[model samples]
Target: MKKITLVFLLIILATTSAQALSWAYPFVVWSGNVYEVTTEEVKNSVISKRIGEVKTKPNDTTGNYYGNASNEYPKGTQYFAISDISTDTAIAVRVKKEKYVKAVFVHKASSHWNPYYYFILFVVAVVLFSLLGKKRFH
Candidate 1:
């Protein structure tokens, strides 16, 4: 029974880790601002108007031209699709749109792994092991 419980716990942990790695949010960086597509409604409603084709160099990290070390738009500026005209700055633009850029290279928000969660898990395992060991010895 103890072995079965341990196996089940291991399975749960594996599933959680897999889910954490696979999930990702989609976003677009335009005019030095990041916009995250939260729902299907926003993704469908928001459309980027093509101004003109501009050559862009890929960044070192993401290998994307839009957001590199410079953090500026490409040389040739074309499209200007304003979802919210109220914002004066890029940071404000993110706040206004309710989509903030977590990382420039990825151009998306990544869920951070909290160490406390693992610490709690470890404590629980230790407690469970102590309890089980005591039972087995008695």
Candidate 2:
């Protein structure tokens, strides 16, 4: 039973961590402001420039963009942003540590997760086992 429960938890964490982040490779997006950060930390980001709307030819596909960064990135640039950033449109940033292109689903809002849901499920499991009784009924 303990092994089953442990496995279940590992599976949940694995899936959530995997699905939550599309790419964990170290990358940087500076509002172009100077800042210091580690792979997990971001700071001192500045808005370099917001993409302005322009006339597009037919079959043009684009979204609201507000920032820019070189895909290859220049030296002395931060690798990842520790500060929160939002834009009307999501822009793809370059990851220096990674080989291919990747994206992060930046939310303009916060997220909510119910902790009680897990507690309730745990209670249900306990109740079911108690009702079933121990083997040999001892």
The prediction achieving the highest TM-score against the true structure is: 1
The digit string of per-residue lDDT tens for model 2 on 23-131 reads 3233323342212112332222432332322111111122112233222344333223222444322332323433212224333322222345679999999988987
User: Could you tell me the lDDT of residue 74 within candidate 1?
Assistant: 41
Candidate 2: what lDDT?
0.35
**Candidate 1 at 33: error in angstroms?**
13
lDDT of 1 by residue, 40-136 (tens): 2323134333323223433434434343112333444333233443222212112123332222223342333344667999999999999999999
Q: Candidate 1: lDDT over CA atoms?
A: 0.40
Residue 30 error, candidate 2, Å: 26
Candidate 2's C-alpha runs over 4 A off are: 1-113, 134-138
lDDT against the true structure, each candidate? 0.40, 0.35
Task: Estimate the TM-score of every prediction.
Answer: 0.26, 0.19
Error of 1 at 67 (Å): 22
